[model samples]
Target: MKILILGAGQVGSSLAKYLGSDDENDITIIDKDEANLSSLQRHLDIKTVCGHASYPNILEEAGIKEMDMVIAVTKSDEGNMLACQMAHTLYQVDKKVARVRTAEYLHRKELFSDSAIPIDFIITPEGLVTDYIKRVVEEPGAEQVFEFENGLVQLVETRAYAGTPIVGHPIKELHEHLPKIHMRIVSLYRNGKAIPAYGDTVIKDGDRVYFVTKKSSVSKVLKEFRRLDKAYRNIIIAGGGHIGLNLAKHLEKNHRVRIIELDKERVIEIAE
Candidate 1:
C-alpha cells in the first residue's frame, strides 16, 4: 500500500516509523521543516517531502495520485482538514484519515461526509487522551484500561503491589478469592519480560499483570490484585489545555474539580 502522510511532527513521524516498518507499505511524509524531513529520511526507509501539505502542487509532488491512503496529522487543524479534503477531491484517495484537534470542528459531524469534508476517519488526540485518563481514574487499580465488545468486556493492566490479596498467590487461586467475579489473567510481565499466565504461575510484587473481565465486574476483580483506592471526589488539574480542560469537564459533574492555569487569558477562556 502506498501511504502519504502530512506533517512531520511527533504524531506524523511516529506514524511514518510504524507504517514504514511494514514491508508492504510505501510511506511518504510531508512537512514544512527541512530538518525534520532530513531526520526522518536518515532514520526510516520512507520518502520525505518538505512543503505546505495542503497545497495542491505539494500533494502532487508527494505522489498523491498514487497514494492508497492519505493521513493528515499536521499540528494545524485547518491544515489537516484541508489536506484530507484535497486528497479526496483531487486524488480521490481510497482512505483519508486526519487529526482534527479543535472541538468546534469535531462537534459539527455533518461537516465530515462524502458531500462535505470527505474525511474517512478523524483522530482527536485530546479526546483520546481524555478518554484514556477517564478510564484510568474510573478503575482505581488499573494503569491502563481498554474496552471491547461494546463495553461489555474490558482489558486492564495493573501492577502487583506488596500486600495485595493476589500477590504471592497462584493464578488458579483467583477464582477462590473472588467467587462471584469472572475474570482471566491474559498475560503477566516481570522485569520487562513475559511470564506465562498459567494456573500455577504466581503473581509477584512489581509484576505487570494484564487481565480481561466483564465490564461490570472490573472493579470487583481488580480488588483481588490490589486494594482499591478511595473514590476520587475533589480533583485539581494544573493546566487548562485541551486535555486538561476536557478532563475537568468530564469530572466536574460528579467530582469537585478545580483547574489552575498560568495564563490569565486561557483561564478566562476555560471559565467561560
Candidate 2:
C-alpha cells in the first residue's frame, strides 16, 4: 500500500511515522515547509516532497496515480478539499480523506454533489473528540455505542451497575418480557478480556454489557433496568483532535457538547 499525505504537521507526521513503521505500506509526506519536511526525514524512511500540495501539479509530481490512499491534512480546508478532489477525480486514488474544520462539507449533501470534486471521506478531528466526550458523559456506564444501518440498529455498551435490577437475572428470564424482542448478549467484556457465553450466562454487576437491539426497542429495554448510566446534558472537552471533531458531528445533532483547544493552528482548523 502506498499512502500520500499532505502537510508534515502533527497529524500528518504522526500518521506517516506509524505507517512507515508498518513494513507493508509505503508513505510519502508533502509539505510547504522545508524545515518541517527535514524534521520528519530524520525519523522515518518516508519520502518527502516540498510544495504547496493544494495544487494538482504537486499531487501529480508526488505520483498520486500510484498512491493507494491520499490524506489531506493541510491547515486549510480548501487546500485539503482541493487535494482530495484532485486525488479522486484526476488520479482516481482508491481512498481519499480530507481533513475539514467546519464539517459542513461532509454534513451537507449539496457540497459533495459538485461534479469536479468526488471525495470518498471527510474527517473532522474536533467533531470526533466531541462525540467521544458525549458518549462518556451521557452513558458513563457504557464503554462505547455504535449505531448501525442509519441508526436503525443500536449496539450499546454499559458497565452493569451494582445491584442492577437485571443483575443475577438469566437471559432466558429477561426474554420473557418481550418473548420476541430478539435480544442478543453477544460477548462479555470483563476485566479487559472478552468471553463468549451461552444463554445460561448470568448477568453480573460491574460486568461490561454489550447488547444489540432494534433501535426502537433500545429505550424500552434500557428503561426496564431503571437506567443506571449517566445522562449528560453538557460536555466539556479539553482537546480537539480527530476524535473530538468526529464526536461533535455525531453527537451535536442530538446533544450539547463543547470543546476547548489552546493551539491556534488546531483551533483555526477546528473552528468553522
Candidate 3:
C-alpha cells in the first residue's frame, strides 16, 4: 500500500518505523522540521519531505495525488484537519485519517462529513485510551475487554478460578449451566499455551478464558466465572487533563465521579 504521513513527531516517526519495516507498504512522510525528517530518513526507507504538513505545494511534493491514504498528525489540530480535507477534496484520496485533539471539533461530528471536512477517520489518542480504561473499570473482573457493534457485544477475558461454575466441566456444559443465556468460549489459555476450546474441551481451573456474549449478559456470565467485583459508583481521578476529563464525562452519567486538580483554570474548564 502507498501511504502519505504528515508530521514527523513521535506519532509520525513511530508510524513510519512500523510501516517502513513492512516491504508491502510505501510510506512518504512530511514535516516542517528538517532535523526530524533527516533522522527518520536515516533509519527508515521512507521518503521524507520537509515543509509545513498542511501546505498544498508540500502535499503535492509528497505525492498525495498518487498515494493510497493520507494520515495527518501535526501538532496543530487545524493543520491536521485541513491536510485531510485537502487530501480528499483535491487529491481524491480514498482514505483520510487525521489525529484530531480538539474536543470542540470532535463534539461536532458533522464537521467531518464529506460535505464538510471529508475525513474518513479521526484518531484521538487520549480519547481512545480513555474509553479503553473506562471499559476495564466498567467490566470488573475482566482481565481485558474488547467492544464491538457499538458496545452491543463484548469479548471478555477472565480467569477461571477453582470453585467457579464450569471450571471442571466441558465447554458444552456452559450452555447447560445457564440454559437461557447464550455464551461462547472462543479461546482458553492454560500454562502459557493456547488450549483449543471445543465442545468437549474441559475448562480447567487457572485457565485464562476468553468468551463472547451480549453486553447485557456480561455481568451475569461473569458470575459463572468467579465472584464479581462491586460496581464502581464513586470514582476519584487525579488530574483533569484530556484523558481524565473525557473519562469523567463518560462515567459521570452512571458513576459519582470527582476530579482533583491543582490547576484552577483547568478546574474551571472542567466545570464548563
Best by TM-score: 3
User: Ten consecutive residues with minimal summed lDDT in candidate 1?
Assistant: 218-227
Question: What tens-digit string does per-residue lDDT give for candidate 1 at 1-272?
Answer: 99999999999999999999999999999999999999999999998899999999999999999999999999899999988888888788999999988888888999999999999999998998998888888888899999899878999998888898889989999999888788999999999999899999999999999999998898888777788898888889999999999899888888899999999999999989
lDDT of each: 0.92, 0.76, 0.90
Which runs in model 2 stand beyond 4 Å of their true positions? Answer: 17-24, 33-39, 88-95, 131-141, 223-272
Question: Would you list the clashing residue pairs of candidate 1?
Answer: none
Which scores greater on lDDT, model 1 or model 2?
1
| Per-candidate total of colliding backbone pairs | 0, 22, 0
Q: For residues 177-213, write the lDDT of model 3, one tens digit per residue.
A: 8899888988889999998999999888888989999
Error of 2 at 107 (Å): 4.4
TM-score of 1: 0.90
Query: What is the clash count of model 3?
Result: 0
Runs of candidate 3 exceeding 4 Å displacement: none
- Model 3: lDDT of residue 24: 98
In angstroms, the error of model 3 at 92 is 3.4
Q: Give the candidates in order of TM-score, highest first.
A: 3, 1, 2
Q: Candidate 2 at residue 232, lDDT?
A: 62
